[model samples]
Target chain A: MSLIQEVSSFLTHEADLLDQGNFEAWLELYEDDALYWVPSSPEQTDMKGQVSIMLEDVPLLKLRVRRLSHPRAYAVTPKPATIHLIGNINASEEDSLVMVSSKLIMTQVRDNVATSLSGAVTHHLKRSEGGFGIKLKRVDLIEAGGTFSAISVPL
Target chain B: MLTIDEINNIAGVDGMQARAYTDPDIFELEMDQIFRRAWIFIGHDSQVPNSGDFIRTRMGVDEILLVRQPDSSLRVLSNNCTHRGTRLCAVAQGNTKSFVCPYHAWGFALDGVLKAVPDIESYPGSFDIKDKALHLISAARVESYRGFIFASKATAGPNLYDFLGRMTEAIDNLLDRSPDGEIVMEGGHFSVRYHGNWKLHHENANDTVHPGYVHESSVTSARQAEGGVTPQDELVDRGQTKGMMASNGLTAKDWNAIELNGLPQGHSFMGGFYKSGLLAPQQSDAAIETYREALEASHGKEKAAKILGMDRFNNLVWPNLNVNAQFHQIRVVYPVAVNETIIKGYCFRLKGAPDEIFYRAVRFLGTLVSPASMIFSDDLEIFGRVQAGLETGSLDRLDSRRGIKTDQKNGNALQSTTSSELPLRTQSKAWRHWMSPDT
Candidate 1:
């Protein structure tokens, strides 16, 4: 496959793993120093002194995955099944590092109620022994300043 | 409609009726008696540090405009316009000299004085500009304790100090931790709406028992990851779960060491955990050292250690605010309906402290209290479940009787075990008093 195609495929596969709840495999897709951030505000930049929806290092991310998998995790017991439709894929590469951006529409359903979370997801990818690993993943939701219910599942 | 007797029927010592959480009529009455009369937290002084700086917030159902006047004083004005009752300010926060109503261009100065009306000539002779000045419906009483501002709608009541009672010490403990004795509101806010009664959020603030069970998954996962040998099935076992106290990095012994204080006026705090090194894990060694040095420099080593070593956790200020001192954030709860509530979390920056110290507080808020928190998600789930369950009418009374027999009254404060239900009982007592016809 072409370079762009290779990157798109990898992105598609990552979404698939998340949607399928194969969290263990998804956790392995990140570099040790990777940052997974979902900004609470539209133009939030600083993670240290500002609050974000999700700002997880590898350890925190692993804990999140483990919690989701716990049988008694009432928040996930009747799990909110999710489907992530990723499109508008764009990629650029320089010095073995690739920058990819995509539009995401994630539909999460639980107890017959469905919530559609649409956002722009940007990924900073680094070439690893196995294709690529995520250096940083930032998801900026369209409803940045709006009130939200429990965002139990990762977006 | 709930009758006076029905409202009076709420007993803090016993359990409360389900309608208290499900009845819309009671909710409206609460908006009047409880929210309007109580000294609700409006905004911090740091939010509007300079003249013309203003922030908009809500006092119960009424919109409030907290503006910094040119005189360097703060005024909490009704955001409603004098003419046609249109809302004067539309934006959440900004620095502006004046606010103009969008409907008909009626303008008011920063201190809520009438500035202009475009077509004054078009009005009848009865239109007197002096009387037409923006109806400055100021909060009956506005007071601040260590920069935290609270406003009341009632024209008469106990002052903020009397209302705060023993809970004032918790606020003092929070401010004293700062070397300069001040905290600046920083970091953006995180707002989450839950399908639950506002009381649930208030009660949960000082709740010690629910965390272990609700946050079992996250706590168990963290423990297992740290090489602890809790069996997967054992961790999931409902009977064995220890709630929040045992969750994350906190052990059962650490939970036991915590003391719960049920203060008067519906306020309460959880203490005795600050010395256990729970907060230490959230801070880097360098940041802690720097913050400690600063604290010592200001208050000397001994007193600074006492302030820094405070064990207070969630401190509820009666009706609306939850001050989490250790985390350096205040959560304001707004009830939209019987089953809908919005919680806004604001993290503060300790003035004169290093940037890393403030960042550590922000990190704690982001990881533990934000909507994305695995720990908080569990509580949210329980809140939704409780709301849904209340609708069934299967459970008429929710229990708050735990540790009641062991509770000891010292002056106005109630002291009990770490896991006591005294906080909920204390809150209900205040709820009964506030919702009464003759408050």
Candidate 2:
């Protein structure tokens, strides 16, 4: 497969692992220095100075993963089953920076109430030796500032 | 004259009358009599430390624009446009020269004086913008106490400090915990909407007895993750031994031995956590020191230790604010409906504490109250269940029969114990007063 196709396949496979409740597989997709950030602001240009809804180092991320899968976790009793559809993947390059954008629809259900959250996600992926590591993943929800229920896991 | 019978019949202590939460008529009455007449917290003066910085906030249902003036003073103005009554500012916060209305292009200064209107010769040339009629409607009274700002819409009533009563000491305690003698609002706010009433969450703060029960599963899970020890038992031993010392664990009897301190103005706290068998030694030490120094500075050493030992309870500040100074956080409740409520979690900087101290507080929020928090998830379930049950329109009353007649009254505040109904009963007193015809 071509480089673009390989990257696309990797992204799709990762989403599937999340859907299948294979959290360990999902964690393997990121580099050791990787950061998972969900910016609170739609126009947030930088995470270094601003706060994100989810800002995790590797250790914090692992703890969150454990909490989600823990049997005693009451929040996930009616687990939020989700299906992420990624489309319109656009890849570009500027000064060796590879940027990708995709239209995403993440349908999640909790307590039998389904919510389809559609957004444009931009991923700044840096090519590593064997795979691509995310420098940044920005999800611009059509509605980011309104009141929301809990969002515990990766979108 | 409203008899206690009428108050009880109109609304039970535990569950409220449907009209109190659902009916727009009652809301209007509350807006006119309670919100407008009472001194309500706007924003801390520290929020906008520099001139021209501003944040848009609300009181009850009224929209307001809180701005820092050129002289570094703060002003609260109605966010509505003076012209066609359009909302002057739509964004959450930002700094600007002067707000210009998009509709008719009317301009207003930051202090809210009418600066200009585009058409000079449209109406009478004698139209003077300097008149107070052209300015944004200012709050009836604006005042500050220890950098915390408040405003009331009605012209008549007590000044800010007088309204705060003994709660002023509570705010002082928060500030005193800070090394620099003052605290500022820090960290981003997490706004949450609950399926239940706002008062339920406010009342939950003073509930010392419910934490171990409602949060048992989360506590158990958290304890399990930490290996063969529990956090609560560790917390208690730390207080007696001082500094990271882990000793014998607490029994259910230990929880029963915890004391509850109920303060004036419907505020109360449960005090036995210091001796509880939960917190690690150092965690308990630092927390106790922060409380002790603040209390001692205001009152001597013995009085301070007494106050510090008395510290750990939830504070329900009159109408809407539920504060937990131990956690350096406050939860502000906005009632959306008789059945729905919106809660905003705000964390504070304890002035002079280390970054780690603040981080521990944030971790406490992370472990216990955040949306992803295990404890809050269980809380939300109970709130949701309460909402579901209340929708049945049944005549079932909320039970507050734990320690009713035995509670001591100190002015308007009620004092009770772990097994007491004082905190819940105190809240109902404030609720009744506000819901009355002549509060």
Best-fitting candidate, scored by TM-score = 1
Fnat measured on candidate 1: 0.69
**lDDT, candidates in the order shown:** 0.80, 0.65
Candidate 2 retains true contacts at a fraction of 0.18
Q: Please give the distance, in angstroms, between residue A33's alpha carbon in candidate 2 and its true position after superposition.
A: 7.8
Model 1 interface Cα RMSD in Å: 8.1
For every candidate structure, what is the RMSD over all alpha carbons to the true structure, in angstroms?
Answer: 4.8, 6.2
| Candidate 2: tens digits of C-alpha lDDT, residues B30-75 | 6665667677777776788888888898777778888889987778
Residue B327 alpha-carbon offset, candidate 2, angstroms: 3.5
Please list all clashing residue pairs in model 1, or write none if there are none: B211-B243, B211-B244, B212-B242, B212-B243, B212-B244, B213-B243, B274-B311
Show model 2 residue runs off by greater than 4 Å. A21-36, A39-52, A56-74, A88-104, A116-146, B1-8, B13-15, B71-73, B120-134, B226-258, B284-310, B337-339, B350-352, B361-370, B410-412, B419-421
What docking grade does candidate 1 earn?
Answer: medium
